[model samples]
Target: MTCSACHQGLPADARFCPACGTPAAPGAGRPVPAAPGLPLPEDKRKPVTVLFCDMVGSTALSGALDPETLRTLTLRWFGLMSAEIEARGGTPEKFIGDAVMAVFGVPHVHEDDARRALAAALGIREALKRFNAELERTLGLRIGIRIGVNTGQVVAGSDATARQALVSGETVNVAARLEQNAGPGEILIGPQTLSAAGPTVAVEEAGPLALKGKTDRVPAYRLLALGADDPELLRRFDIAFVGRRTELARLAEETHAARRGTRLLHLAGEAGTGKTRLLREWRTRATGPGHLVHGAGRCRGYGDHGSLAPLADAVRTVLAEAPRSADGHQDDIALGVLAAGLLDDGTPNVPLEEMCAALATVLARTARTCRPVLVLDDWHWAPPPLVRAVELLHIRLGDAPVLLVCAGRPGGAAPPATAIPLRLEGLDRAEAARLAADLIGAPRTPVAARLLERAEGNPLYLEQLLLPADAGTPALPDDELPPTLQALLGARIGALDPAERFVLDIACVVGREFDPAELARLAATAPGTAAPPDGDEPPTVLPVLQRLRRRRLVEPVGTGPRSPYRFAGGLVQEVAYASLSKRTKAERHEQAARLPSVTQAGDAAVGGHLERACRLR
Candidate 1:
């Protein structure tokens, strides 16, 4: 058989097309048969944002229109809604009558899935307005929609290559309920969805409502509008900036040096390690000097506008405050042209060299009076053209009072040789405790201690753990990781190739630190282990380990072919382990229990694995 949607050939008993995720004819309820070279479907629990959108008063519209006209209108609505959802990194799961269900953070995951879901919801709202205008002109009638968005845990099962409605759980049900409760043209969002979306979304309290199937009163919000995409808007400025005294001092010194000549500083850290927070604090301090010109821009991981996006933001910010050239009309016009080009799409109409030269000239001119500081946030996502532009600016603006700061996660693009490198680790124990106390609005307590120990000096982690306390909600259980952190770490692990992920899962089961030989042994018998491409031997673990290291997911404990390795962070190990189903974890633990005992500790470890296996089973 073949899929009518995409015309992909399918096996005789296939219920859904593996290539397009399209359902076969009526009553075809079996799982899609795996074709040759295709991987079987995998089911795993994950945090996802679910969106439910339904046409308002659809039954009335159906009564007013002919059957054929209603069919055409329904297809048009689905096309508009699906396009908006997919464009914003959401998967259009399925359509039920006039209702549409979509999901984000599945089949693939991004750290900003919640935000993306909210954006898609807003986009659908706007798209429908235009669509209604068309309908009014052609059919002399308009339609309305009500949307609901919710975020929570769901079990997602689907083929690796297909985008479909694979998630099933309370989260999906809650979204549908929210949609049902909403009024025409209104968008209602659950509390978790609003929190995960951060501070940039403008909303008003819809108060607590008794939702169907939910015992407790579920608090909902009416999404008004999303603020600018500025990364700064998402942060909590009211939270006291803790630690980083030394890093701030270094930044001050860089600002001073820029007075004499140009300087480049690369600030590196892992996710939620306070890179952006530190930059914000430094910018605040530097701006107080009254003799500096500071401008900043952020690079987005999705929908990267162009190579020079960050630089353009910096330029536009500086030009907003910079004084015009005193030379002549021609100089002012040139500066205007340069600013316009940079502010456009960041795709330069001129040659890259010329654009860089023009930027250098603009910055050089601005620096004649006040020191110019340009900050590039999330530099890891910077395209090659942006990197090249920075290199050129470094060379062309020599001896000019320009300071360039690039901040990003570890293992990203390398900075220039002359750029000063600053790596930010977790805060010290004292600082971490202090931060927790401040966020909790009280002195240290047992709960704070547990949070500190688990967070391991990571400021963001501690803050997220304490968020419940601030809201008068009960503290999270000791074993539970925050949902937001799970999404962040899960996205990282999810980005790995199938082989690397398999090895990483095995490593998670072994322990925080494990021998490569032991990992290889576990992986050899691990379910779903793929053979080497050549099929000459069992898959090697070394190459996969190295790739994980490069991605900053794991690191070497010592040196040698058999050197022990560890996950980059404790939370990372937990997230990876959590990704496995209980059965798979039990199976891995059972296999691990049979490894040859090399020492007394090894014997105890084997017993421990057996105990866990028994408990899990």
Candidate 2:
């Protein structure tokens, strides 16, 4: 017989293409050959540990890089995974495209299938650390993997026609479920597998949680550390000022408690108040050996037609490392479903609740061995379905160490008291001053106090205020500056021609990160009179941002002249944007929002430019 994708030699009774590793579905290119001695359905029997491995943050990885680069990176990632799986005496069942399904004690029995699965997961984690560092420096990318394990009786089969370690039973489903529950860099195991494996990594009883699609509540645990806590283990966030100490300690206490068996933990705070920062820090401290599944949701605003942004980000992250092709020619089909559902955006498709449920099922199985970290940020503005899903997940994962930490504006439906609440308020005068001194590298004296006061002791405001103006004592005023933070931010807001102010408004709307190209194009068509800047050269409007930055209003991203700027105080930015004239604000917002995202050049947003443009017309 021959393979469908590639003409490769293979036995007539083969389940997978020997050369291309694709399914040998009949009528395409291959014929199924029968063996007279093949066991009847009842005669088939085998015992093996099913293993599931997937990438974390795979889709978003495409956003930061080009396709060609992503391809190379993907290959390297899978190469490492393939090597580890093979060395552990495991059968690489099939590639799932950015995910891999492998089995142990299949085709042959190992005395310690459970132990081997655990060993394989650990090996992959260790190999990935060095791999991730290099990738971070070269491609500026970060990736993680999750694994699930379960062992049970199975129908080991050679269809009267095909073969290749096909095992069908409840075990395979259980294993997939455990893997689905795992966090990035964590592994999950069912009762049968966990009991057999014994302790290699620290194990915490995660209690029991209801597995989706199944009526029974599956017992689970969370993997906290490979061994004991090691201070020497360097963390990514620690190297940058991005993670603040306050945020870390605030979330860590509850998280550490969760590892000891507390199930529900909620983190609440304002945007840019470092809620995500704390979550990252807590995750770094919490990851160990068992199931540490994590998922996040971020809310959408304005031009964004709402989203399950956090779940999408988390699922993509966890599945980023799945295998694309088994033999380098054909694609894995199960992974195709995930890719089409996740990465493909043009279809106007609303994903099935079942699909997310299935993914969660896999996550639960994957994370069954440890407490999972489910961090949701900016949840106040999340789509309604996402909120409902989260509520359901908490009840289902009640038995698992699935700590739910969230960051967003306050005063939503009140959370339970057991949910840890962290409120991020504006800094006190001294704390704000320390931050000003840290960012500016200049000592803050009584003179800086007035500046902090005007900014209302807002750290973001303080940082922006410290930016140097071109001339003496900066271009901003001291004489009765705008009163509140919004007014203070608006002090220099009215100065620019309509175009520059329009640009600022968009920057404020887009949050902390944005692309200058999009901002520029939006400026061109807005107000109708604004013209496209000549050449590919960056518009001279950079000076507007420069002036804004110096006045401690805008903060330049990327340190490039053409780089976009963002409001230092997101609160101020939000309030200022709200204060604009409806028609005037709508005109500029409509025009600027018309442009595609920097990475999504061809796929214009739905009803994008037309809808906004129509408002003005």
Candidate 3:
């Protein structure tokens, strides 16, 4: 094949470009140029560990030694791992400022990337051992090196010439995190990779752990012996996940109780406020005998989406774990198990009753076995018929220590009082600042303030305003602001009939506290007893006003002869008022001025004050 880099020719089995010093990017399929002229892309692959290693304490070490000595030291260190890495068929992606990133099973496929990565890690340790020995013997100077390896898939390709195919994924991130957490002469890897490569390297189980951005604490094992196979030691040697500190502690308290007896907990939250985050966190913390079963039904289209969906899902998962004999116990017990507090008719055809029975059966089995976490997300959208079934399951499920977590949308649409609620607001200025700093890679104090103003402490909005590239700097009306929430309010306001709209418009001018007499004059709905052609007395607007309150659109601010009503909520009322015709507005002001002002010697009051404002029109 011809060298894609320098256009020079090369033989089969040649792993890298010779003339241009370009490596053949790993992939399964034949390398086809992108067009008339372009390099190939990395093949589609699953998660794998990626390792990026850098020679640390270099600047200090380089200053003490000459360039020749430094290069000699660097090359010697590189020579040990360079061949070792290539031997395992890992692509040495690049070398930068005393650092290098190597990827395994990327473009080329490997069923066990985790295994290959762990082997490479062991190789690095070996290389360090030899190099450290040589340095002590020859140079008489003791120095340390650090290595970080993480396994996951990356999009590899020539960033420019398309020759350098690099694996870019969170695997790379975990490697960096592993390295950052490393000390001199240490190697760290993720648990999944450790398991995949277990036979090759010896590791010791560290403990239950947590990591940043991860809701759950990860089960971690420390590498004690390379490829140790002592079954007992097998449990110990794996990667330690670090991050969520609080969730782990709470799970420990809950699950420990469940191990002794049946227990239940209702983890509740609005969608995306981290309910799932906490569930995942609990999983890591509640490992072992207390298994977890999960299912979710999102509330999107239906007032009732049928609770049976999640209930069915949860039961199906639990049933999968039961042995064949457990099925016999149902008939063996000689008692018809009521599903979700509802007795099932002996017919097998009713899905609702069958679903209820499934929960009862699962709950009974779990009581005999280990407690498990059952999660259902978005119960609000469950279809009306599904509501009773789902609610029954929740009711039948008692409160002890087993987790019964359900998350849904906030407000009336919120979960029942049985579920604990967490009201999520926006981030404070500091969190926004921290996030912004992380995005920008530096602190922009001024930019942070701007985000606070636009976001108004709404994490979702603040996050949108902060561009991914520069968190502190807002993206503006273009890529930033959430136009949907604004549009939703606007659409709701737009859907209102003219009379309702008129009430809101006049409310803006007369205010919620305006005298009823003045508001009736402004809105022209005060005239009573006007019969329609059908002989229906015209509907009083007070009913319409109350309807608005029921819909949470507005409310009566006072009850008196000069009572006023306020807009149900939000700033849209003002916008509606501003949309009125100038002449209609002027006439309303004319009517308002004739009313007595509240401030004028008890005779002319605020009514007159509002009337004066109306008169000015």
Candidate of highest TM-score: 1
Q: Give the higher-lDDT candidate: 1 or 2.
A: 1
Tens digits of per-residue lDDT for model 1, 1-617: 33433223355567775543455675333334332222342577778999999999998999999999999999999999998887766889889899999999876666778889998999999999899999999999999999999998888863444556578999998899999889899999988887777778898878577888999887888999987755557555466888899999989888888877899989998877899889888878874443677788887665527668788888788867876556633346556657567678776768888877777887887876567789999876655567778888888899998999989876545565567899899999988887787777775553446667779888778877776632412356778776688888887777665566778887898888877777776776666644345644444578778889998889999877667898878888988888877788899889877766423477777788988989989
Would you list the C-alpha lDDT of every candidate in the order shown? 0.77, 0.54, 0.49
Q: Can you give the TM-score per candidate against the true fold?
A: 0.86, 0.35, 0.39
**Alpha-carbon runs more than 4 Å astray in model 1:** 1-41, 158-160, 163-165, 210-212, 215-217, 228-233, 287-290, 303-307, 323-330, 411-418, 443-449, 469-475, 530-539, 597-608
Superposed on all Cα atoms, model 3 deviates from the true structure by an RMSD in Å of 23.3
Q: Between 1 and 2, whose TM-score is larger?
A: 1
Better TM-score candidate (2, 3): 3
Worst 10 residues of 1 by lDDT: 30-39
Backbone clash count for every predicted candidate, in the order shown: 0, 50, 66
Q: Whole-model lDDT for model 1 versus the true structure?
A: 0.77
As a TM-score, model 2 comes out at 0.35
Q: Rank the candidates by lDDT, best first.
A: 1, 2, 3
Best by lDDT: 1
Question: How displaced is residue 579 in candidate 2, in Å?
Answer: 7.0
What is the C-alpha lDDT profile of model 3 across 1-617, one tens digit per residue? 34332223344556764433345545311333321111122122234457767776888888888899889888877777777676565667777768777776433433334555566667777878778888889777655666666544344432222445666666677676666566676666665455345445666554344555557554445555555322223221132222334545665665675555444444443222344444555665556653454433333221122324554555445555634344455442313333332223222234654555455555655554445555665554433344445455555555433455555443223354355444333345666555455444565544646555555443334333443422212233532222222322333443343355455555555543555445544444322212333643333356556655654567667666345666653333533443344444555555555555433436445455455556646
